[model samples]
Target: MPPIHLLDLSFQETAEAIAAFVVETDEGPVLVETGPHSTWPHLEGALHKLGYRPEDVRQVLLTHIHLDHAGAAWAFAKKGAVIHVHPVGAPHLAHPDKLLHSARRIYQDQMDTLWGQMEPIAESQLHTPADGEEIEIGGVVFRALYTPGHATHHIAWQVGADVFTGDVGGVRIPGGVVMPPCPPPDIHIEHWLESIARIKQAGAERLWLTHFGPVDEPVPHLDALAARLLDWANWMRPWFESGTPPEEVTPRFQQYVQEQLRSEGITDPQVLQRYELANPAWMSVWGLMRYWKKKLARG
Candidate 1:
C-alpha cells in the first residue's frame, strides 16, 4: 500500500475534529478530503509540511458535497485540479448558491465565522464518476462505491485494501466510541443500513474516517457504527411521533448521548467537545426526526 498521510484541519482549533488525506501516487499527490474553507490555512500549512504547494495537487476525490468535507475543494480546482465527486453533487459544487443559501438559513450569523467563503468551481473542472467506477491517478487506483444514506450523494473511495468511509463510517476519535453523524434532509435509516452492508461487503482491511482518522479493525468499527445508527434513530422515533419540538428535544438528546460517551470512559470534557464538533447532538436530533417523519408519512 502506498503512503496515505493524514492532515488535521483542526476545525475550530479542535484537533481530530476534521481531517484531509493526501496520497502519493505516480502522478504526484491527490487529496481525499478538504475539511472546510475556514481551515484552508491549516490545510495549506499541512501541505507545506509535506513539501508540496496546494497548486501541485492535480486531483481531488471527495466522498460527498458536505461543506466540512468538500468546501475547500474549489480552492484546489482554482489551481487547475480535477474535482471528482458524486454525480448528484457535481451540480451543487459547480453552482453553490443554493447550497450556501440553505446552509446560511441554518448557520445564520455563525456562517462566515464557522465555514468561511465558498466559491463555485467551473463545470468543466468537475468529474462525476459512476458507482463502482475506478479512476486511476498516477499509480493509485480509487474505486468509487456509492454509499448513500448519510447523504444521497455519498461515496466511499476504495483504494487497494483500504476504504475511505467518509461520514458514513461514523465519527470517532482516539478512545471514543463510534457514533453516527445524522444531519437532516437526507438521513434515511434503512438506506444507511444497506450502505453499511455495502461497506462490509467491500472487504476492506482498513476504514478511513473523515471525522478523525483510520480504523484498522474495519468490521468491528463498521458494525458498531451501524448499531449506533439504529440506536439513535430508534431513540428519536417516539419523540417525532409525540410532537416533541426540536428545541425541547435537542438538549435532552445531547445529555443522553453524553452519558453514552461517559459510560465509554471518555471523561474528558475537551474530548467530548471534539465529538460534538465532529458530529453535533442537535443535528442528529433533527436528522433522526426527519427520517422518522418521512418514513411514517410514506407508511
Candidate 2:
C-alpha cells in the first residue's frame, strides 16, 4: 500500500458524486478515476497541491466507462497516461458516440455544464484489463476483480485488503448507511447480489468507494447494502408487476430511498445531494423496472 491520497476534486457538496485517487507509485502518480470534466481544474489543483504535475500521472485505471468514472480520461490520456479499463468498456472509450448521445439525452442542458467535454481516447493509450490480470504500476500490483452488477463492464481493483469498489459495493451516505443505486437497463438484482457476495468473500480490509471515501466495518455495511439492494427491488417489483410504468415507478422509488436516508439520520439537504450523485435513485429505479420488464417479456 503506497498510502493512496484521496482528492475530493469533484466538489460534491450538493450531491454524492465521484472521488478521484492519486496513488503514488514507483512509476509515478496514478489516477483511479477522473471525476467529471467540470472538476478538471480542481483535480489539477489537487495534483499540484500533492507535489505533482498533471504529467506525473503514468497510469489511469478506470472501473468502467461511465461518464463519472472515465469521462475525463481524455484529459490524462492526452498527457501520455495509459488508460486501463474493462474490455467491455474499451470500445466506448475509443469511440464515445453512443455514450455521449445517451448522456446528452439524460442530462439535457446540464450535460456539458456538469460533465465538461468527453473526448475520445487514442487506441494506443487504451488498455483493456482481463479478470485476474495483475497490473504492476510503480511496483504496486492491483488485481482486477470483474464485479459487474452496477455496470456490465464494471471491475473492482484489489490491492492488498483495500478494494476500489467503484459502484459495486453500493453507495455509503455520509451518515454511514449503504444503499443500492439501481440505475436502469443493466441493474440486474441477482448479478448485483452475487457481486456483493464476491466482495464480502474477498475479506477486504477496507472498501474504497469512488463516491466518497473508505469504510472498514465490512460486515455491517455490506449487510446494509445487501438488504437495501433487495428491499429496493422488492419495493419496485410490485409496481412493475402491476403494469405500472417506469415513469410512475420513479417517484415511488425515490420516496422509498428518501425515507430510508431519513431513517439513517442523514437529514441535511447537502447530504441528500451527495447521495443523489452516488446513485441517482430515479435512474436506478428505471433500470430495475427495465430489467423486470425484459425478464417478464422473455418468460
Candidate 3:
C-alpha cells in the first residue's frame, strides 16, 4: 500500500482545522481535499516540507466540492492534474461562478480571506466517478462512496480499510469534542444517518477526517458522531417549530455547544473559539432548521 501523508493546512492560523491527504505512489502524488484556496500557500509549504512541488501532483480527488474541501482543486488542475469528483459536483467545478456566488452570500466581505480564488477546472481535466466506482491512481485504489447529508455532492473515498470521510465524519479538533458541521442548504438528518451507516458497512478500520486527522477507532467514533448528529438535529427541531429566528437561535446554540464542550473538558476560550470557527453554531442552526422544515413539508 502506498503511504498516506496528512498535510495540515493551518486554516485561520489554527492547527488541525483542515487537512489535505497526500498518497505517494510510483506514478506521482495524489492529493485529496485541497482545502480552501485561502490556505493554498500553506499547503504548498507543507508539500515543500515533504519534498514535493505543486506540479508533482498528478491527480486530485475531492470528497466534495464545498469550497473548503475543493476550492484550491483548480490550482492542482492548473498544474496538469486530473481532478476526480462526484458527478453532481463536476459541473460546479467546471464552471464555479454559481458556487462562488452562493458562497459570497454566506461569506460577504470575508470571501477572499476565507476561500481565496476558485478557478474553474476545464472539462477535459475533470473526471466524475460513479458512486461505487473504484479509481486507481498510481498504485492506490480509492473507492468513491456517495455520502451526502453534509452536502448533496459529498462522497467518502475508501482506500483499503481507511476511509477519507469529508464532513460525513463530523469535525473534531485534536483534543476537542466532535461536532457535526451542518452547514446550510444541504443538511438532511435522514440522509446523514444513512450515510453514516454506509460508512460503517464499509467496515473501515480507520477514518481520515478532512476536518483533522485519522481516527483509529472507527466504530465508536462513527457511533458517537451519529448520536451527536441526531442529538443536534433534535435539539434544533423545536427551535424551528417555535418560529425562532436564526439570529436568536445562533447564540443559544453556541452556548449549548460550549456547555457540551465544557462537560467534555474543553474549557479554554481559544480552543472553544476554534471549534466555533470549524463548525459554527449559526451554520448548524440554519442547516438543522432547514432539515426540520423540509421534513415537515415531506410529511
Which model scores highest in TM-score?
1
Predicted candidate 1 versus true structure: per-residue lDDT over 15-95, tens digit per residue: 989999999998889999898899999999999999889999989999999999998999999999999999999999999
Model 2 per-residue lDDT tens digits across residues 208-265: 8887778887778778888888887778778889988777877777788888888877
TM-score on alpha carbons, each prediction: 0.99, 0.95, 0.98
Give the alpha carbon lDDT tens digit for every residue of 19-124 in model 3. 9999887788889999999999999999998899999998899999988899999999998999999899999999999999999999899999999998889999
Candidate 3 stretches with Cα past 4 Å from truth are: none
Give the clashing pairs for model 1.
27-138
Off by over 4 Å in 1: none
Per-residue error (Å), model 3, residue 115? 0.7
What ranking emerges by TM-score with the best candidate at the front?
A: 1, 3, 2
Error at 142, model 2, angstroms: 0.8
Cα error, residue 234 of model 3, in Å, equals 0.7
The pairs that clash in candidate 3 are none
Indicate whether candidate 2 or candidate 3 has the larger lDDT: 3
